[model samples]
Target: MKLYSLMTTAVLIASTSAYYVKNQKSETFSLNVTPVDAGTQEECKTCITFAGQTINDLLQFVLQEEVDVCGDLCQIVVDKTGKEALGVICTILCDVVGIKEFINAIQKADLDPIYFCELVPACPINDNGDAHFTSLEVMPKKGPQGEFDISFEYVSNNGTGTGMLAISVDTVDGIPLGDDFLNFAQPAGTYDGTIKLDAKENPDCDPTQGPCETWEPGTYTIHLSVCNGECGSNHPHSAIYDTKTTTFEITQN
Candidate 1:
């Protein structure tokens, strides 16, 4: 695991993360996609796709408070689908991949069940490749201000274990900050790094014009996005493969 560390102060940034929120398909979103003739790489395309989408739906249906509970949720879906076979395969793959200490890491990590099926014998890996963050660790959970550090690990399909990284921090209430981290260039492999940062009052806010911004004491979310090459702000030209967000609260010292 390659590790890099940096220290910096918080700057206000327009939260462009709204674009990443997935819009769930309508109430009647159908899971009926016909299997295409893709040779041997996708023999289980239909089953895998159906299972994967079902998993996604089950996950989304969970109440926000219980979103992280997957074991019971997943078991319910498998039972409902009448496809105990796939559940068995999932258990086998979960064990064989050793992705997490426990087999349910598949559900815990929210790994795309379809893409994960790529590990199955008949459903070969996608030729397009993949990139994602495996873990995010932070300290002083109260907030990301002075004397705070965040470490995260990521894996990508790029030949070299490097790629571009962009980070943004914002309050859940939609307060504005400065233009924070843009893009740190790296490669397309597995890498680990930490960044030390301090939260700041809105640097752009002027007291003469209005109240100088204060770092509110509440929940704030930090977003990290990685791209195969260049990352775009809007829909087109967006090659971002993975995005992860961690939330922390700010309190009076």
Candidate 2:
């Protein structure tokens, strides 16, 4: 049942809220990460469908706003006291014994995905992974000409499928770069910001199918690859499950 056709890969960085009021003092920052081991292939087996599917029905339809796991600790508030640090913060890391980690390690765990959606779980037939950070945007500093706007969200199926959402950065010496593809169509969703970054090989996302760049900051990484490709299209055209890889991280302070 590899009827692949699922691509919800996104990375957006917004700019021009008057360019953060014209850089007040330089604390400008933006960092976002969404990765919980996406969906470990073999058709797609995100922790064997939660083994018994209970952690609130596997996050009411698989995470959208927040779900915390891994040693029990979570914080994604990039910025909250602006007098000089505009704003931006997003952090997500997973694999804490999976299956939604007993309701994301409970501490009042209820981030709201329609209040656990209905215990999520419907893409199964090989579900094809991705459940976290349905949306994220951060812009700390660097405007006046740097500009910004970024977005990310995944999980869709209308029938036919194919997926690959990507964005990357880091190469002062670390080398991990990508900046191409604001949106790659299908029955997918969410793809904003089709302007800005006019130079440096042109890439706010998807300049022709690749990760191009010109923003030299510090550390960076952003990639989202979800390929269900209409479930392999009758296995022809050099068949190969299409694609599947969900990774996240965006940093600059």
> Evaluated with TM-score, which candidate comes out highest?
1
Q: Kindly provide the TM-score of model 1 when superposed on the true structure, using C-alpha atoms.
A: 0.40
Error of 2 at 226 (Å): 6.0
TM-score of 2: 0.22
Candidate 1 structure quality by residue, lDDT tens digits, 91-210: 444344443332233344254433334333334332254568897666778853444466667775643111235566676447543222322222345666565445555466567875
TM-score of each: 0.40, 0.22
Which candidate number maximizes lDDT?
1
Model 2 stretches with alpha carbons more than 4 Å out: 1-121, 124-145, 148-164, 170-172, 177-226, 229-253
Candidate 1 worst ten-residue window by lDDT: 18-27
RMSD of 1: 16.9
